[model samples]
Target: MTGWRAIIPLNLGRERKTRLAGRLSPSERERLVEAMALHVIDQLRSAGSVAEIYVLSPAEPGFPGTQWLKDTRCGLNQELAHVLGGERMLVIHADLPLLDANEVEALLREADKVGAAIAPDRATTGTNALALRDPGAFIPAFGEGSFARHRTLLPDAAIVVRPGLQIDVDKPEDLELALKSGATSIACPI
Candidate 1:
């Protein structure tokens, strides 16, 4: 059995904004995103998993102890393969503020057993996390309706249903809901 490692796909852009339209200023939204990332990373490191956490983003001096994939040409699948190095991988989106270590570990364990697993977001359109023993499963299909596509590809993959894993902050309504519930982040603290 292959050991489990984590791959966090972070699209670090200067003008990144969580709120759609003009709900929040660009700077304010970026700051909130940073805070959420920090919180999530801290929680994951605290979990004490031997699995490596591969962060694919430009170097953020504020965040350390992460392996950054600076190559822009390396799409999500390539970056994931580069970081994970052919081992079983658990891929999680950076926007999931409520992603806890326990939930992550659960998905990893299930993947280990079933060879594939998926944690669908609230809309069931976007996949927040996916676990696969094979790197081929990490193809670049992360847009809407991806959850169903993944399920179609891997029918026997385990399905983990948890509110924390399902809720991802993509727009203002999502962020507001997460804030109201005091959602935690998956950011690592180095």
Candidate 2:
């Protein structure tokens, strides 16, 4: 209960992953989103530093165990900003299909040493995972070029670089990358 609270912000709306529409069917996209979200939840559950997992989405709690938080309908950054206060928090994107226990532990270790930690995407321009010890003082700034913005905002934050932490499925090529990396079944936590 004293450890960091993990939050995975999900967009379960009709507009989810519209960018990938040309590459995948609507149902396929939804399945991919659900699988990745479940994968993220499972990874958090396996990690020792994660005290609790919360899913912030407008949809019902489709996944078990994690507490459901009704999204504010505001964008991710604004909604997450409201929850960043009063506790140590980890905000991770749900599309990381390769995330495993070791990467989560490493990110936590880096965060513990510094006041905060950030895992940038493969392009090193976006943030895939973020951990904040004194979250009350840090605003969630997730968007285009977020990695540099976050680093500039939190100078003491450790930049954690790992394969699992960096790969996130955003474009059509990213899906190929994940599949090539053997992400055959992301929801199978076992």
RMSD vs true structure, all candidates: 3.7, 2.3
| Candidate 1 ranges beyond 4 A from true positions | 18-21, 48-50, 58-62, 74-85, 136-140, 184-190
lDDT of 2 by residue, 1-190 (tens): 3787999999766567777889887878888888888888999999999999999888876698798878979888888887778667999999999999789989988888887999999999999999987788567789999999999999889999998899899898888888889786543321
Which predicted model would earn the best lDDT? 2
Candidate with best TM-score: 2
Write model 1 residue lDDT over 1-190, tens digit each, in one string.
5456666677676467544446666666666667766655665565444256667775543465555556464566565545554767777777677767788778777887788889999988878888887755346456668899889878899988877788787787887787676674422210
Error of 1 at 176 (Å): 1.3
The runs of at least 3 residues in candidate 2 whose Cα sits more than 4 Å from the true structure, single-residue gaps closed, are 186-190
TM-score for model 1?
0.83
| Residue 158 Cα positional deviation in candidate 1, in Å, after optimal superposition | 0.9
Q: What's the lDDT for all of these models? A: 0.69, 0.86
What is the lDDT, from 0 to 100, of the residue 130 in candidate 2?
95
**Could you give me the TM-score of model 2 versus the true structure?**
0.94
